[model samples]
Target: MAITTFPMIEKCTSIDRENDIVVTDLDGTLLRGRNSFAYFALVAFDVDGVLRLLFLLLASPIAGILYYFISESAGIQVIVFATFVGMKVFDIESAARNVLPKFYSEDLHPESWRVFSSCGKTCVLTATPRIMVEPFLKDYLGTDIVLGTEIETYKGRATGFVRPPGVLVGKNKVDTLTSTFGDTQPDIGLGDRDTDIPFMTLCKEGYFVPSNLKVNAVSTKVLPKPIVFHDGRFIKKLTPLVSLLIILWIPLGFLLACVRLSVMSFLPIPLQYYAFLATGIRLIINGIPPLHIKKSKGLLFVCCHKTILDNIFLSVALDRPVPVVTYSTSRFLNIFSPIKTITLTRDRAFDASMIKKLLKQRDLTIFPEGTTSRGQFLLRFSSLFAEITNEIVPVAMETKMSMFHGTTTRGWKWMDPFFFLMNPRPTYEITFLNKLSYEFTCKSGKSSHEVANYVQKVIAETLSYECTTFTRKDKYMALDTIVKNP
Candidate 1:
């Protein structure tokens, strides 16, 4: 069956009607490796051809053992080589094709092409071999007139040598496109790789996709399509191996923490700081990717009054010294093991002075939400702490668990720990959203209540959590309950 051409839609068609947008190149410029039809073809499949090849690879030893005797009689070596190579290529190609359509839905392909074709005469300018990419162009991209390296073909076989235009690198790409298309300039051009920079410079707008980072960094405008792989995805299937790795991490991490603590107890004050830094590194190694912690630098984290161990996990997540902002509670004063840095209670003027001192020294971490809530809910902010002079590097941490093993339900006190020790289950993913900054309204002008609400909103937006202002009176029956029980 002939590959169906995708029709361009209205969304992709924009710019001066008088000018033209000539697209150059594939696999990064116009198409992303991940979200492209090619990417889908390679990844999204039930029984992938690669799997079949792998199965053959696994079975090869057994087959070799069985065929040892038969090998001497027949040309076994030649047969095996032919079979494996043929099967590997066939399966890989087939799997790629099967996965492609799922990524580029029937309607999306046409919509994209309509945007492409509508701009001007659309053409695929790529470094990939023409024969290799043509089928994809015909089926998924719906673009003809592909400018790519022509592979040498003797009859049906691909010869080792490539014909003229041997190298499609750098200026070669631009010269080839300009020479063919002539003086009529393309209005818009897109490429993912640096090689397309020359080609992009020729066009009115050149869109370049950066390394694993989408939203082209180049000064030239980028097309919104194929920036990031956004299919209508609900559930991400984790392979058994990945699930196993996640499960194995719990015990491994616990043991490392214990060991690190033991070593730190005997170390000097300076070494203790190093130990704190090492803790952050350990977290990164153990599967918890860093959130807002850049360069593994130390941070002063101001967190909500939730569980006592939020800092511990946050520290683990950051893999750095997260100086937690804490109240001058007597219980915390006595317990110094977990306390990285302390902010002693002082007069409002003194508190401001102390905050300034802390800010100048290290990276800070803070949870604008004053109180913790039931796992399902978020509490309002108490921004008495947020009246700092520096920009508040805010973090919204959303903790999700398939099973509520380590979670606290309603009526739980602040001291009550959640996500402590539990049997291994489906993974609990803690995501730290982007850091935000807040402008301090005024020394006396910004009401504490207003600051609290603003902080709450920032946290809610970042973490996609529903934030509610819950006072201590509304939540707890008595203040004594926190001191006595918590």
Candidate 2:
């Protein structure tokens, strides 16, 4: 005596008397690996099915290739028909049971995800022999009906001849299913192979699995969004793969040896030195930050204040014709110094006029924060250069795996680059968040103050940092009062 049980529980729903017939296909839809499993079953049953199929083709090369393509493309029809003709009915229950683990798993199989509550009356309508498939039906699939090929048996011994349900291909599949369940219909239909096409067509809407397959079993193909797997790491498709690859490869030994001496040679010169050096300097920065320029036109980069080396690294990373918008004294300092002519004037009264000229002539880089924090808290940003007409791209920079604000300006001299030289190797991570519109269109009809807060909040969120806002009164409040007169 054998037993029957459904693996998952089903939700009970009384079928409306009007429309209760739910017909679906089995092979590629309900049955995950029907073709390969059926082939395995035939091999297990006849033991020479593989050799016989091969010998048949070896006897006739053309017929063998045709058979291969037929088996590959329309697996359900060829395997079922071939199995029925190959051997007498034997107990395929064990063979079918053995194949269950391959088809279903907690991982790849989608059956567990979509089955929902299994209280409803269900059945599996397949073209496979009933005995060879009943195990999957009893174990993995809880569907009530199993309408497949009928195998002959005498005293539970082997008899090769099989009787298939009348014309079990295509539309006849819908008829078989309807005959099994009568007027009761199911809520969902699924199929994968081309032979299951007619069976799926019986349903209102059905989805094909592994949708890229040429011969889809269902009309509408439903598939998960593609995720990228690179070197055993999963990433979203939109994430920048090339930039990440460059970052990871920069710390390699061989590549470092080749370009290290060349890298050290440019250290004595100001970052602006490499900036104007042009050709080779351009290639180095291109490897660091790959830019996606639109129309080959230059754009402005708004950044945070870190150090003088900050502007240099920006110039090198950007590689484009961007002139840093610094103060008049800084511009004067760079004029006699090794700095290029791209630095802008920071005269307060003429700030608006100068910005218009910079946008018209060249791409501008401005540190909107105006002052530097110890790499910890983001300070209130000055709205001075925020009104630039050119595109404003906010660039957030932080060192990877470094102590918070490694050396503060209070302890280290602001003018000297000694701290940078003395410190051990620093791996700086610079991430360029997407470009914002040049025009500051206030969202939700926000006022200037609200807009400023929003911009500050947006930048803070983008960099994964916190910021403190100080009003004019807050700054004026005696530092001695907060310090307790000590």
| lDDT winner | 1
- Predictions in order: lDDT: 0.45, 0.43
Per-residue CA lDDT of candidate 1, range 26-86, in tens? 5544443322222321232222233422333344455455445443212222223322332
Q: What is the alpha-carbon lDDT for the whole of candidate 2? A: 0.43
Per-residue lDDT over 268-366 for candidate 2, one digit per residue giving the tens place of the 0 to 100 score: 443444433432222122223444642234466667665444555565455433456664224222532333434344565577677777577666677
